[model samples]
Target chain A: MPLARRIIPCLDIKNGRVVKNVNFHHGTWDAGDPVELAAMYDRQGGDEVVFLDINASWEQRSATLDILTRAAEQVFIPLTIGGGVTAVEHVRSYLRAGADKVSINTGAVKDPDLINQSAEIFGSSTIVIAIDMKRRPTGGWEVYLQGGRTPTGIDGLKWAEEAWRRGAGELLVTSMDADGTRNGYDMELHQALANLVDIPVIASGGAGTLDHIAEVLTTGKADAALVASIFHSGQYTVDDAKQYLAAKGVPVRR
Target chain B: MAARIVIVDYDMGNLQSVRNAFKAVGYQAEISPDPASVLHADGIVLPGMGAFGNGMRKLAERDLIDPILEFATGGRPVLGICLGMQLLFEYGEEYGGGPGLGLLTGRATRLPDTVKLPQIGWNLVEPVAAAHPIFEGLDQPYYAYFDHSYAAADVAPADVAAVTDYGRVFPSVVARRNIIGIQFHPEKSSRVGLQMLTNFGRIVCHSRSTLR
Candidate 1:
């Protein structure tokens, strides 16, 4: 049989707490405990859970690790941690703290070699290069950093190709324009990136209805879809999204 | 006394999670690189993740190669998971083809690139044989988590316990006498995975008692 298209719930963590209204400059508001929400997602059959610590400090990173350590005990599925991860040691520490994988966003774009070195130490499968992008006014997507605050002017597709060549096992492409819009995923952006890389592409950012999730997997050719508000605000359960996708003949783990 | 299980650690990855899974099944498995501990164990759980070549180098670095071969040949139970399963075979093609422990007759090769690499997610595991100590209470077509880019190729049919597919049918579970290998993370695979571990635990205990 074919592999199931994964439904991953993303938890944007700040200072060790799950934050909902996070948009770079305005500051983040606490939503719930990171570990508790992760365990709940685990029980709800989230194929995987992503914990992105936005704008975290050295101390807050450790605190996030504590949450991951606690969550790993209860959450049986894979847990991926991101944010403030620039060095190889950060990847090591997070994996030790029970993250099955680590996503490198700004760090990778700046150093580039950081992706290769981390992949060498932790294995490519454990290293995910997350490309946060904003559609350029001219054309193409530009890489964004610092919680999507700063634009690096790096071409998203070129960077994704380089990251893959540097040994990134997966690519997490998030569209800043569509993020939190509830309009739907940036299918054209995700599809273009997904086509560029042979590795798994996790389509992230805008996720509204069950159709959005299904459309990204089928039309965008995303191997997995990541959603946040829909699952967090109790608008839809992970299972409901999964059942809807499965009924649409898109294979999903039930 | 409970069976003394050792989870061989070579810095491959996921060693702690593997130990936690065994612990959850009521076995206090030691995570050790010491050859003596491996030799003394009633059963060995070789847990690994990452590239095939790197894993072999780690085994050689820790001087675990010969001791593991001896333990497996000595008729004690041994279970290999994921990359650990691939390590049991004769060769692996991830990052270029190289020799493995050579306990099982096969080569681990990359899955067809048509499907996404690392093929992460749950898939059905169907037992090839009617009876095995590991399949205990599990029904056919049960889902187990899989996160792998490669699968064992040219394995002896008689030794394969279960098979799963991701663009192609590949061995999911293989067993021969006291040696067994599973290409999924039982710990991260939830309840059914724990149940499989429990069954392996029972096999360990039974083998220990019989030996005594």
Candidate 2:
């Protein structure tokens, strides 16, 4: 009846290798080979896998693309590649390399029209605008860029609306405050963004337990949850997460 | 000889994944824009992404329309995926209306406004025909990855092989004779999807033997 909420295991890749970070920076560790890890996730019944090229210089970006080409060969489920994608050509290259979708973070914030242009050429569904949000010292949240290092004065809620109007198919919102904390997702952030945009919102950051996932998908109203450390550390398999969700009455593909 | 499967390439999105999926199932498919290759293939897979109008225009530009149309009627398992599936219909209401291949008796219309556009993610595909070969070994109401805003609406009831609900029940899989159109990406739908592709491969092999 209803569309199943997606559980996407995000592979934060550095130099063509999978890595996990704390709060988008500290306590980084190598996970494994990107292609092998992706295939493993697919076998484990992951709904989708994201390869975020975390320090994607030109050489590393090419390396990531090579990984995607190889990963697409084995991983039969959807694969989304993100990070350091600034131009339309980058989007084209990723898709050609077999990425189902290309996510743009800083690229979108710098040139909001990149959303309009890429969505026009490649169709909206292929363009995912990843927004990294941090709670401002004041009350609301501000959008961050450059792997959540630079804070933009733009309001996170307003920027999401702009991206949607520009024809972004989905929003991958990562909470800088909650990321790597292993506490929970920023429910307030996800609930607000999901309510503002009609497009699908993927809630990222701080998923310690199954209840946190259930909370986000139900009360948070997110269409998908992007998980990293839990699955990476062998603490939980994607199937384990889905089973827990299904037991808790969350509609996950089992 | 191995089944001469040709995936029509008219500059649509990544066809490598589709070919890889076939390879994973012990089949090799050639990606070609040549109409002659398409006409000669034992099976044809029309894979596409992006807008429907652009897809049709690209097909027309490459002089592939007639060959594909001919292949559809000539039998031998013609499969269309996503936008390729939409193009098999008579008309598409996307990008301000355009003519399709008219291989099936329906039009691609936008999903109801009740749901989000580009209903991206996995949804349950309930087999309407119950015995279609493409659904062999698949659990009924299996989860398949779908990503599109427009789907084949007003399809003939008998031609509908499966249906999935987003905003409303739309034709997720439609089949008539040797031609099959699937709105979901079986290549990206994991094992359930791979099973469908494997079944399609079997259908192609059986059809070839039948012709001989």
Candidate 3:
């Protein structure tokens, strides 16, 4: 069957509220309550919801998952929880707590086997290989793990293939280089991995307008696009992106 | 009650996305890496996303291979996605030679660079058979997201459901009897994806009569 595309709204939560900025690498200003923010997207209508704990490090273990579980009970769509997820147990906790999928970025690069361990237990579909990337000073995109601190020499595209080979069901390719910038998605990164694996790829980074959504869907072959700034800032709703893409003749889950 | 879809959560596949896609539509699905729950569900989804041999090994290690084979062959409604779909075949050449469930007479193999090993992106999947129920919600020449290096070949002519064009026409969705498999992520394929899931839900609901 010909499957339609997904418009996913990402909620970067800090201190229990949605927050955003040009890039998370910079400063993040408070957006709003995560439940309220999530409900807004649910109303606007998104196929799935991704809630990332931007400050999970400073909190209790799995504080983010607890927050996600609380929010998930309220939302009808799928919720993918990320941030500070380092072990298989953490992934299990999220899945058991109600998260449909658990995303790992820093943890995956730190321990590449995290992908296998996750796929082995939770199944690859439940484990998302979240690649938080920044344009390296060396002129190529390098994967940054550990809250975007350590740079792994692995090329972004190679990492995507490797993750899939190691058994990650989906890939959340976020360009830390362009995250929250609202300029647009990192087309090069999106394009590279979009054609690399046949699995689902969620394109995150630089989503400021609906036109960028169309561009990523058409050019990057991304199954879904994750928007943070526009949705978090109330510039566009999940409906807005759906209408935008629909106007372009692309089918979206209404 | 709507069909209680059980997703087999062996490390062999992507199970949560399947459950999430169903739950998003208000359908109840449970994730049980355990086989007892898997065999008991009204309908089962084998949503896979990994190496084929290892997938079979995981199933074998958990003693799930035979039960799942019986479920698929015993007239239970089962849907397999990606590698899960590939595993339904007779065998695969991934990592090394591994025996498949042999539910369908075909083998999965890696595509050469000529067709781009992983035919990633949204491609137009053309249905080979007309009026198949699994593809009902999908639009004609609909777009489904795919990420894989291997493709199913030597499929039994009766099983090919949809043929998607990458560098060439390949089976995107295939079925035999009650078992159906899709190469695309119906969960992540957005609206069309949801439609596909809804169709599966419909099947699960319809199969409730026979399930008990």
Candidate 4:
């Protein structure tokens, strides 16, 4: 069989606590402690866990590292930490703290060289470039930065190609339009990115049901599906999602 | 006494996770750069990430290559993980190609172009040698997390303990007497991975008792 499609549970953290928000803003609520939630996901057979420091401030950066250290102790699966990663030192600090990979968004947009430099220093596999994309009013998606607050006029597809060329090992593409709706992933958006890049693309944003996830991994051509609200809201556990995927003929690790 | 398992730190990548994984499995593992410590340890774990050429260069610069070889050939158990596992082979065809540690008789080559590069995520591992200690208490065709683009290509069938398929069948687990190499990161492979570490610890203890 080919590689099993990954099911990743994302923990949106703020001030050392896991939080959930819709469309990157509004209705933010406490999910649980980051460490505990990560461990739970790991036990549930989550292919990977992501702790995104949604509110990545200078003071709270250490909190992220603290959570990572504690999670690394018990969670034996791959842990990816993202948010406010701007320099090689930030990547180094996360890796030293036991992060398997570091995801960079705004930093990579601000200095495209950050991807090249960090990848060169710490192998390309260690760097994950997260591109937050919003559907443009005139068609075609555009890249968003600063936690989805600022928008860059560059085309999302074009940026993805550049990021891959500059040494991004994987691309985490999140659709802002479909985010938090629980409707489904933007299939067209993900399909376009997946077809364009040779690297693995993780589909994020809208994942309401198991069928949505299976669709994204299959029709959307995504290598993995990143689910947050659905898992955090108790609508489905990682095991439930994996079983459903397996029953649907999607090859999962189980 | 517990076995002294020193994880060789050659500045390749994160050793803390490897040590943490060992700790989670009820074993104490220390990350050390001192060659003498590695040479004297009851068991040595070579863990790494990144390109094969860069990994070899780092090992050479830190003067760990010779000590590791001596320890492996000395009949003490030596386990290599991920890039560290690839380093056990004779050569690697990545980043301009370079010589490996030559402990195993295969060369590391890139996965076929038909499949995705860096074949990240979990895949099934089928034990070829059921008697190998690493497969103890583990089910056949178990799943392990793998994250690599290159794998052992021309390994002797006698040395391959397990195999995983991507674009084609490759040696996912290779064992030759006291030396074993796992292309997957057992440290990140959850309970099954932890069991493998425990099995390695048992092997270390068994070797120590027999030596006495």
Q: State the lDDT of candidate 2 residue by residue for B1-212, as single tens digits.
A: 98888999999877889999999999999999999999899999999887899999999999999999888788779999999999999999997999999999999999988887778889999898978888899746889999888999999999999989888888899999899999999999999989989998999999988976
> After best superposition, candidate 4 residue B67: deviation in angstroms?
2.4
How would the docking of model 4 be graded?
A: high
A12-92 in candidate 4: lDDT tens per residue? 888889998887777788889988998899899998999898765655688888898999999999999999888899998
DockQ of each: 0.57, 0.88, 0.08, 0.80
Off by over 4 Å in 1: A22-29, B93-99, B113-116
Q: List, residue by residue over B117-191, the lDDT tens digit for candidate 4.
A: 788789999998979997899857888998899999999889999999999999999999889999999989988
Candidate 2, residue B16: the lDDT equals 85
Best by lDDT: 2
Q: What would the per-residue lDDT of candidate 3 be over residues A1-254, giving only the tens digit for each residue?
A: 23467888888776667776565567777877887777667667776789887774734645566677666555656678888888887887777676767898888887899899888776566778899888877676887776667777888778889998998878999888777667888888888887788677899888878999999988878878988777776777788788889899886755
Task: Please report, as a residue range, the 10-residue window in candidate 1 chain B with the lowest summed lDDT.
Answer: B113-122
First chain TM-score in every candidate?
A: 0.96, 0.98, 0.93, 0.98
Query: Among all windows of ten consecutive residues in candidate 2 chain A, which has the lowest summed lDDT?
Result: A54-63
Return the candidate ranking by DockQ, descending.
2, 4, 1, 3
Number of the candidate with higher lDDT, 2 or 4: 2
Weakest 10 consecutive residues of candidate 3 chain A by summed lDDT: A56-65
The alpha-carbon RMSD over the true interface for every model, in angstroms, is: 1.7, 0.9, 6.6, 1.1
Q: Scored by CA lDDT, what does every candidate get? A: 0.87, 0.91, 0.78, 0.91
